[model samples]
Target: MARITKGILGGFSGKVGTIVGANWRGKDIIRSIPNPSNKPPSEKQMLQQMKFKLVVSFLRPLGSIQKKYFGLNSGSKSRINLAVSYTINEAVQIVADVPELIYNKILITKGDLTGFQDVAATPQAGNKIGLTWEDNTVQGNAAGTDRVTIVCYCRELGSFAVFEAAAERSALAAEVTLPTIYTGREMQVWAYLNTKEKNVACNSSYLGALTMI
Candidate 1:
């Protein structure tokens, strides 16, 4: 029998304390080591970068797992589970100083076929509506001939910001697309956000959400 590497599912035991401590301390320490000119990264910059990297790393395994374990019809349950751990941690770490980080929130406002009508004039097989930040994309069920909009409610800020391209055609689903360069039972989308801007918040929804048609 061919040896099957369990991959992440093999359940490798990771050192929690070591990983956390090293990630937390190493990030700050390295940035503060100072450059030839003796200028060091600000504490805020360190924290932002660390948080962004951590979230992207966490998503690394999730994307592959999704392609392997779940397909378009599997719904969002598995993806949600994979994302929660990293999402919560990123949320906590980013807002450690500012309570608003924890308090400010995002949620799915609209779901189902009824809401879809409002977004699309003649909803068909490919149209969808949902909240997306930078990369986050969520698609609704195409049960009815209506446009669906998934609204995300942000607590600190009144009302949610709907994605501009929520109803646009999918770049991935178009027919004349080139053949996939690589084939895998699994895949993941990794993102690295620039965190140098002061007072600019990292968009947590960049990966976007998607569901079965």
Candidate 2:
């Protein structure tokens, strides 16, 4: 059987250009879903709608940073501390399509500066397993000065039932991990003539997994 792993990276923000204020607004990430109706919608349309939903529920909250820091003086350096929250709930529908049978253990890694809460796991099918994580808190020094990264890994078991059914089994097992880093940017929301700027951004991210074997 073959093993597969996928990584996604996004949320890039750069310094302001000639444009008025900062234009580093958040955007949503989406996966393709088949349309049930014959004339339902085009793939682009479906994806756009999904993106809109994600922006509304996850990205819009970040706009508060602008409102809170609207009065900063011109040419004064300021940060936009925004917290964008997101959730992942993906279903493969067919585990055989994955071509891999995972067993043993799974591990997740994140920065010590962040706190993760409310982790849950569930098995939905005979050959499938599901995991969910949420509620992450980011810590930064002097507000809007810290960043956090997240990574995950899973161990495979050669003795798993699915591996047993395969005609060929290797003595070695493979481990899966997300290679890209999930980043949180610092935003300076306020700045005074004598005092420094301060901002607080808090958000959560979730990953859903379905494993076979």
Candidate 3:
């Protein structure tokens, strides 16, 4: 094998016949074109491809939600990546060909810390969602929580709203005003406690559906 060092031909940067030249990580490199395959996909290949499609279809729309809500608050991409990866892995089990990351579709927490005791949501007139929760820390101490993260999901319209509120030493309840388009659609609500120790969050508690007025 011939290794063409950068000092030899300087820096090459285009495709020439069967060989392509490019710079990767500040180093110039050259490689031959891959041979085309005419073979049909096997059963396992088809199944794996279907699984990937299923997972991607479900997870693709979540990027916006993650970017808008979790990206900043979590401080790093690790947590968001973990959640997305886990959901994708779980998407392999699609009994009815449903491609969605529902509340019950996968494990919510990576740790055993208890989440919110009880949570409920109601839609007020002005396209507002009022959320209430009871802290389980009083009776039993879980991981010390710093904030409550609420996910309001509208299953019918594929829309959502995210809210965060202070949780330490307090019951931690608040409301979020959604867009006017979300007024008439029913929604599912979930609550999870984010710990004081950063990047650690509690499992989600299904707060049930809300009748948006």
Candidate 4:
């Protein structure tokens, strides 16, 4: 790789001949494209690709939440990148040759903020999901005004519904209505708290799953 410094086409991007140029951080750089190989993928390589695809697809919908509350960016890696790496490595399981996400092991948000206590998720009337938790404000870095975020994932749909700032820690309760399409599906629930200023977040707690009414 070479930094593009002082040239007629300064800071160029995209492929030109055998080299590809793009901006990284703030610098323009170019690198030679590796020649395509005719060799078949190894079994290990295929397994790795499967794991990567599963993690990326699962986390893509939570991009906004991950960007705000996931681990801090390290060097060139963004928070989302960190989240993907963590999920792929620690939260995935290979069962009977199939890669699957361990719902409870997934972390929608990661930080040092105080988390919830005695949290529960239950089915409510009219396709609504009820969330309840004991108020633990002022415990560690928690506060009464801290915002709560709710995440619901329906495996049948391969999708996620996130409610940001659904309620405050003081409320101790909140309800979310699933889309009509999810009316009969089972959903895995998780919740986390963030400061009112959105500066920090708590590790999320999975509150178990329920069938949407």
Q: What is the per-residue lDDT of model 4 for residues 90-175, given as tens digits with 9 covering 90 to 100? A: 89999998899998899999999999999898999898989888878858878999998889999998988888899999999998
lDDT of each: 0.28, 0.26, 0.61, 0.90
- The lDDT of model 2 is 0.26
Q: Pick the candidate with the highest lDDT.
A: 4
Number of the predicted model whose TM-score against the real structure is largest? 4
Better of 1 and 4 by TM-score: 4
The worst-scoring run of ten residues by lDDT in candidate 3 lies at: 67-76
What's the lDDT of the predicted structure labeled candidate 4?
0.90
Give the Cα error of residue 26 in candidate 3, in Å. Answer: 15
Candidate 1: segments with Cα more than 4 A from true spot: 1-38, 65-95, 98-141, 144-213
lDDT of 2 at 112: 20
* Pairwise TM-score winner, candidates 1 and 3: 3
- Model 2 lDDT tens row, 1-213: 211123224322332232222123333323334446767788657654564454334323334433342233233232221111111122111243221212111111111223233434333333332333332323222122222222222222111111111110111111222211211211111111101222322232233343433
Q: How far off is residue 200 in model 3, in Å?
A: 1.2
Error of 4 at 195 (Å): 1.5
What does each candidate score in C-alpha RMSD? 18.7, 22.3, 6.4, 2.5
